[model samples]
Target: MSIWRSYPRSLKVLLLAMLVNSTGMAFLWPLHTIYITQGMGKTLSEAGFVMMLHSAAEIIGSFLGGYLYDRIRGKRTLLLAVLSSACFIFIISIGLSWPVYILMMILLGLGIGTIFPPIYALAGSIWKEGGRKSFNLIYLVLNFGVAIGTALGGIVAQFSFQYVFWVNGFTYLLFIFIVWRALDEPDPVYEAAQKKALDPRPKKEFRPLQSFYSLLILCLGFMFCWVTYIQWQTSISTYIHLLGFPLSSYSALWTINGLLILLGQPLLQWFMDRVKSPVKWQLLSGVIFFILTFALLSQNQSYGGFVTGMVIMTIGEILIFPAVPAIADRLAPLDRRGMYQGLVSGAANVGRTIGPLLGGLLFDGFGPLVLLYSCIFICGFALICFGTYQRLQYIQKEVSTVKVNK
Candidate 1:
């Protein structure tokens, strides 16, 4: 409570907006592959292809949002993104045939993608001192929304998926209203940060270009992480259904994921606080867990096995997801914060774009064992990438020191 009260007004609103946004998204996203596969009688491969397209669109949107935030500022850019998303989502709620449904989903991805960079950028801008705490708080709230939304979405979907679509659309409308009312105010803090960012001088101690190289490397690992992670939503969801688990049971997995994340925050914070080079350790250790997740999945087929795998996966998610943005925040030049954040988001989307298609094809062609083993192999590469990333950062610092001594 004390910590919550300590946040700046804009950050508080940003957190609220993120919560609302993610909750709405959760209502539909967990069900997307399910709907396409069963409701429309599409094959898993077809559903994967559609999801890939949607994620590709989101990549474009992430870039556009970052550029817009850096250029026009967040207020107007956010309004445009939210308004467009709401329109697309409303149309989706109204019902459509296959091809049309596909197109609307892609467009909705664009809108949703644009919303994130600005929110993340603004969180850093508003509370410059908050550092990892700010990103973690945002992440915490996001999962809370997921927890609430997924649980409710499962129930609502039991009755009718039409209502699920409507609920998602309504939340976007609510987000628009919040932005209009709360975010329109003149923010002196953000304005001051913007002005500082415009300064031509570089911080000699910090190398923006080199740091960005590191960020790109980190993002590659992030991309791989998402590739493995997204299987739960894509192939794994369908696989569970084939195993005879109910849709509500599948959705409950996500609910458990979200709830566990919420419950585990304090422990994560403690671990982080005590760790040396926390973010690096977080990435490395998380990838290890990701590998373990798939390894377990390859062997087990029961409900208990799935739950245990999810629990392991959730721990990796807790370690990895929030830390990536926090690292990006640290590395970004004040002027390029939005751009850096965008790249991070875009990288994740790239993984998402690939994951579904790859997982589906692997599952269809080979089987679940092959799919799970493939994920484990990819996660090994992720571990290597993050490890190499830390090494590069260390080398960059040494080079900078040499230049300073000269």
Candidate 2:
């Protein structure tokens, strides 16, 4: 209670808003593949195509949202995002047909995409003293919403998916109200910080380009990470349903995935406290867990095996999600923070756009063995990308240090 209350107004509101929005968002996604496959009688490949378009729109929104955050600095961008998303949710609840549903999904993706980067930038702006704690708390609240929403969503979906739509729209309505009431004010401290977190040229001590280049490298690896991570949401769900598990079982796994993150926050904080270079170690160690997840999945056919894989994957997710944005905050100048944050979201959206389409194609052409093998390769490749970025960063710092001495 004290800890939550200690956060700045903007931070607290962001957390609450995300939790509220995610409660509704959670109800929509897990059922997406199932709804398309079972309810609409569509093929997985077709569903993947629709999801690809949705993700592409999300990428557009990410860039737009970033642009807006940098130019305009308050609730207006967020309100636009949430309000549009609410409209989509409401429309989708009313009608869930073929082309209309797909179009609305793309619109919904854009709306949701528009909402994120500003809040992330807000965390840095509003809670300067808390460092990564601000972002991590947001991530934690996001999954906390996931845990509760998925658990209930699964049960609600068991009755009628129409109910899922209604409830989701209701939550979005709530989200709109929260954003309006809480985020309407502007703070100049946050405004100045939003322009440039640090002076890039401090007596030739730092390269002006370091922060931007660092963000680029980070975005590249993070993109691949999402490419791998998203398969669990899209193709993996389809794969599970194909294996004869109930739809409820498919959603139950997400419930478990969320539940672990909620419970493991304490242990993760403890682990972070003991670590040396948290960002690098967390990246490397978490990808290793991702490797382990694909390795486990490649052979296992049982629900228990999937359950075990979800647990391991959630560990990886916990380590990675909050850390990436926090690292971005460090690497960004005030002027580019929103752009950097948007790029991170853009990368993830790109991955999300591609992961399902490619995974679906791979699954359709090759067997599950091949799909699983491909993920192993993807995860390994992401490891290489991030590892190489770390090396390049070291080289850049060394070169800069040499220049400073001269």
Index of the highest-TM-score prediction: 1
Q: What's each prediction's TM-score? A: 0.88, 0.87
Alpha-carbon local distance difference test for all models = 0.85, 0.81
Local accuracy of candidate 2 as per-residue lDDT tens digits, 1-406: 8976787887777788889988888888878777778878999778767877887899999988888887775477888888888789788877577989999999988988988888788787776667778888888898888777876887898998889988988888888788888764446665565434543344333543766676777788888788889899778988998999998898788778877888897678667867655577788888889989989999898999999999999899888888888878776666676787898889888988788778878988996788888988888777876776656556778897888799
Off by over 4 Å in 2: 32-46, 94-102, 154-166, 184-208, 238-249, 299-302, 390-393
Question: Which candidate ranks first by lDDT, i.e. highest?
Answer: 1
Query: Clashing residue pairs, candidate 1?
Result: none
lDDT of 1 by residue, 225-313 (tens): 99999999879998999999998898788778877899897577767877645678888888998998899988889999899999999
Candidate 2 Cα lDDT to native? 0.81
